[model samples]
Target: MSVSIDKTNSVVLSADHITKTIGAKNIVDNLSFDIHQGEIVGLLGPNGAGKTTTIRMIVGLIQMSKGDVKVCGHSVRHQFVKAIRHIGGIIENPEFYPYMSGFDNLKQYQRMSEGVTESRIHEVIKLVGLQDAIHKKVRAYSLGMRQRLGIAQALLHEPSILILDEPTNGLDPAGIREMRDYLKLIAREEGIAILVSSHLLSEMELMCSRVIVIQEGKLVTERSIGSEVQTDQVTISFRVNKTQPALEAVHQLNDVRVIGTDTNRSEIILQLKEEIIPQIIKILGDADVSIYRIEESKQSLEEEFLKWTGGNRIA
Candidate 1:
């Protein structure tokens, strides 16, 4: 469920040079990024890198030592009531009364929040695909179901930005996929800007359109994911009937290097641009090398994360 971001969309959440300090230590130092409408942005950092601190500041859970956060053009500092009205978040795990039904839990939230109609409650339940289980007591709900219920509670307010911390903390593969799918649904169908913090790199790679990486309380990099990510060179594997001739033919081309080969010596892996692939095929064909298959290997998000963080393991 990859969603394309329209750059023209207005910024929904902005953290402008926000910093958090405790005594002499700066937990989050001057971090800044903007999440646009209909975008799912991932917040990534190694342990103690201020990801949670940054999130806390944005949601107004804690005051920023310096700078400001604006949600839907309302400053969180100057307008706490107005700024917080446009935010819905689950800091860690979503809690519920075990005895209460899922629908009842949402009804309670609706009563606490302002201007949330009963229709909106039903809409969010269906949006998260929990219509069938909405009436079931939350004590009987699975972890995935509980997570969806939490999201529904958060969305009852129709917040412009949804902030989640470790949304998939403990779940099997299927549950993880379910959470990812529903989050994407919220962003695409509801057009809400979502900011998520998670340590699961592989899942983040699949779920997020863009990732904001931090290290030592500083900005490391911000990268686009999936089809939106651009790379000038890719590792291409060419399986041909005659590997030696294919290798020699590709060697004649400039800006191409042989990175690896198969154990059978029937495959040659070269690093070069995709546009020059046809040229390599033509050169191989002229040398009577029959092409069997071709594969282009783009760098995975995990690899890029490691590179950007200088091999620091993500927390």
Candidate 2:
């Protein structure tokens, strides 16, 4: 599916029909998407689903056999130096010099990248909430502190895009929450587009605005997670006097699936469109089944992810 971006060219990162092939196998097939400024997008798929391969191609770690990746209007393949300047990324765990102080570590990176001023470094240090510990040695810093320092280093050059792979790995609950909030803040305050990849579906739900799901190296679906029920289809639990009759009546509706049923309690859970709820009630009433109560529940991201991945465990 094609994602529509703003016509004003607000897209900071775009993978246009990106494909990766290894010998006879196609790892990524015609994958395309856009991440606009101030947006946080999640790259999600089951293990061996080409999530890493796609990310690697975007960062120019591996070459794409076909198609293109553009960052800030510069082609990654043709204008490697120009395109790379707009991106700040942390692939897997971020590395740091354990003997060096956090401030010194950032200063060292400042030397590697042109145009990183000392004030910008301090600004990013404050942005990541490491002001008090900026002088502390990396060896004395916790995993979360090091992660924040990595982010600060990435931000020093003021890149337009940030890509993080499994950024919350090895973090505690509190640390994870801190990382999530900081990322959102950066996307908003810095007006930068951020793309994150992780196996934690629940955390992705909380952190990402939209998610792209790919399966077996193909795009399965892309969806928004801000609303409880983002799609037209919803899961509703119906309580009635006769479970058999209600089930029989609901089965008559098109595009409806009966997922769970309890005969003793006369309850049945169905996945269908919200607009079809009234029709279902009429059908059950016409069937002479006394309707007790109907409750609509939002499908969690993990449930939707499983549905898209065909029950494959996301790793």
Candidate 3:
């Protein structure tokens, strides 16, 4: 499945039939996708599915055996410098000088990068919520703080795209939440496109606007997440005083499947259209089944990911 792109936003990153081969094997085979500005797109796959290889190719760490990548219309094959200049990324753990202050570390990166002003450094530090610890040594920072500092350094150059691999790795629940919030803020406030590769499906569902799934080095599907997700049917649970009567009433409806039942709570779960819900409520009421609650539940990203990948564990 292909994701519906927003025509209003500019495409910042485009992978055009990119492929990577080694010896007789194709590690990344004809993968293609486009990430738009201000959108956070998740790249997902199982083990040896070329997620890393694809990311490496995009960042110019590894050359693609076929096709090309474009960043802001600059081709990676013919205009490496220009294409790469629009991107800032962290492959894995972001390293820093342990003894150096976070501010000084960003300054160190600023000296190596072109057109990075001191004000930009301060701006990113505040953007990542590290203003208070900006002057503290890196050694004194937690993993989450260091991650924020690394992001601040990457943003100093004002790149249009940000790429991160396993950005939430080694972070606690709170730290992961913090990272997700900061990334979303950057995407929304700065209008930066973000491509993130992570094994954390739950976090990705919360953080990304869309997801690109691949298996065996090929594209499996790409779909929207979060608020953009739409489906013809939804899973709903009806908690009533009489489960059997409620189930019987629901069976009268067309295109509705009774997926589960919980006699303990007198709940019956059914898969049906949202429009059919009012009819169900009325039918149950007519049947004299006291309706206590009606709740709609959507499938989690992990469930969808497993279905797409045929039960393969995400790497």
Highest lDDT: give the candidate number: 3
The residue pairs found clashing in candidate 1 are: none
Residue 58, candidate 2: Cα error in Å is 0.7
Per-residue CA lDDT of model 2 for 1-315, tens digit only, reads 443322343888889899899999999988888888888889898989999999999999999999999999999999999999999999878889999999999999998999999899989998899999999999999999999999998888999999999999999999999999999899878988899999999999999877888877877766655533326678787888877777778778766766444333456767678888889989998999999988875678898777667789887
lDDT of 1 at 222: 61
Q: How badly does each model clash, as a count of residue pairs?
A: 0, 0, 0
Q: Residue-wise lDDT of candidate 3 within 108-161, one digit each (tens)?
A: 998899899878987998899998998999999999998888888778889999
Tens-place lDDT per residue, model 1, 1-315, is 011223678999888888898999889888877899988989998889999999989888899999899998999999999999999899979999999999999999888988999999999999999999999999999998999899999999999989999989898899999999999999999999999999999999899987888887877666566544446777787888976677678878876766444423266767677889889989999999999999875678787677567778788
Winner by TM-score: 3
Between candidates 1 and 3, name the one with more favorable TM-score.
Answer: 3
lDDT of each: 0.84, 0.84, 0.85
**Estimated TM-score for each candidate:** 0.78, 0.78, 0.79
The residue pairs in collision within model 3 are none
Q: Least accurate stretch of 10 residues (summed lDDT) in model 2? A: 1-10
